[model samples]
Target: MLSPSPNSIKKAFSRVALVGKYQADGMQEHLGDLAKLLGQQGCEIFIEASTAAHLSLTAYPTKKIETFAGAIDLAVVLGGDGTMLGIGRQLAGSQVPLVGINMGRLGYMTDIPIQSVQTILPQIIAGEYEADTRTLLAAVVLRNGEEINRSLALNDVVVNRSGISGMVGLAVKVNGSFMYNLRSDGLIISTPTGSTAYALSAGGPILHPRVAGILLAPIAPHSLSNRPIVLPQDIMVSIEVVDGREIIVNFDMQSQTHLQTGDTIQVRQSEKTITLLHPRAHSDYKTLREKLHWNEYPSTF
Candidate 1:
């Protein structure tokens, strides 16, 4: 639940969009139920075109992902965190809030469980929820001083060797100043929202989503002295392949592009942000403890 300030004004939502994993078991049934619930609240429901096709649902209005911009007040994503990640990137900068329903294991972003959908959705539609604004990273791949590719990531931007298996040499710079050079399997430049994802699997620290910092974690560095670093969000980070090795750059694990020697990747905080709606009782610590299985006692305790 969001604690409202004295100056805050509550806005009523009348248009909602649904995005889900196509063809997943029981997805159609869940979508049907959700549509009915939203309709009862006097809200206009829209479904993503592909999802509507998959479920053969033509009763509600349908729109393409890109075309649906500005036409929706909120988006309800049904699936795991991956589904939320995709939708978040697509709907970035649109200022449309997202509510994720957990349909997969270890759903950190998708906080609402399947069993609780009936209970939580009503509260949410009634405006009894909290809106958490999360930061996003903007990455640009530059070659010869020209922008070649640009992407927005809700998680981390990873640079690593593509085909060859050995470690690759990388040079890192922060705010146009030399930081360090290292030979490692890869590098992960992650947002606080991403700290719990790939960064954690690579032995990086878990950062609370509210923390305004960027984490730089090296993956299997050849030298033990090359450690992870956390920097303020306003700084710009540039990474270049120094060993003349071909590498790949991945954005939020959703898209990838090849990088050659001397190709530079720049990452900085995006001007855009994603608004995540959570149930009033949502707790970041409780979600972490449950998802990571932290502090669990044995039967004997």
Candidate 2:
């Protein structure tokens, strides 16, 4: 197990906000237990408003998602990666660090297990943890030189066919230079933090968080040779809709908008980043092995 670095911050996370996936089973019980634990540790807890609506957490103080900025020092997110991702976006520019307790399958970001929270969380609270800062991809949709929509993604920005009717033809450009064009089901532009998510399923490489690159992976391209590539994080990638109907673009598969044939989507690295606090022993390779079951050997036939 990796130990907490000697330079770990000391008692820096006191004011904490607790956010959870409201629809999860036993949410009330879990939230209550967690809130009580934080109080005992001499920490102030603020519950996110939406989560309070779903559960009877009336005894504790509640805060809206928008009010989290500048109000809290840390956020303890309880749920899967989806929960973490949602909260991460809201707290992105605020730089309020987040710690995740896993409550769902395949937790790449929500690394701490529920059973271990009682044991591990306190260590983190007491200044024994590691911190990881992840970058975001900011994208804008433009049509006829007019900006239409804009959003930020901690995972990826995808351009895809909206329905089963046809494939989308997209022309790729990097820093104003043309790259290539292809007709495919979709294309995924991912950050290093997202290389393990949908991009991994689409045959993209696993990019270490320390790598200064962005990943581009074609989803089921018509040509088998169209492969995934990592581009310099400093460049802007422009994808123009060359053809096809019912095309769309989405931010981390959460927010989406329809596309016109002449529209262009511009994506680039954002100046904002989200800070993630992990148990001092957290290691990326160890996490991959445990989550992907990399150590499991197959039975001989």
Scored by TM-score, the top model is: 2
The global Cα lDDT (0 to 1) of model 2 is: 0.89
Q: Choose the strongest candidate by lDDT.
A: 2
Residue 79 accuracy (lDDT) in model 2: 95
Residue-by-residue lDDT tens digits, candidate 2, 1-120: 976543343456778889888889988888899987777667788998989878868988999878888888889999999888888888889868999998756588999988889988
Error of 1 at 173 (Å): 0.3
Error of model 1, residue 28, in angstroms: 1.4
| lDDT score, candidate 1 | 0.88
Residue-pair clashes per prediction, in order, are 1, 0
> lDDT score, residue 109, model 1?
88
Model 2 C-alpha RMSD vs. true structure (Å) is 4.6
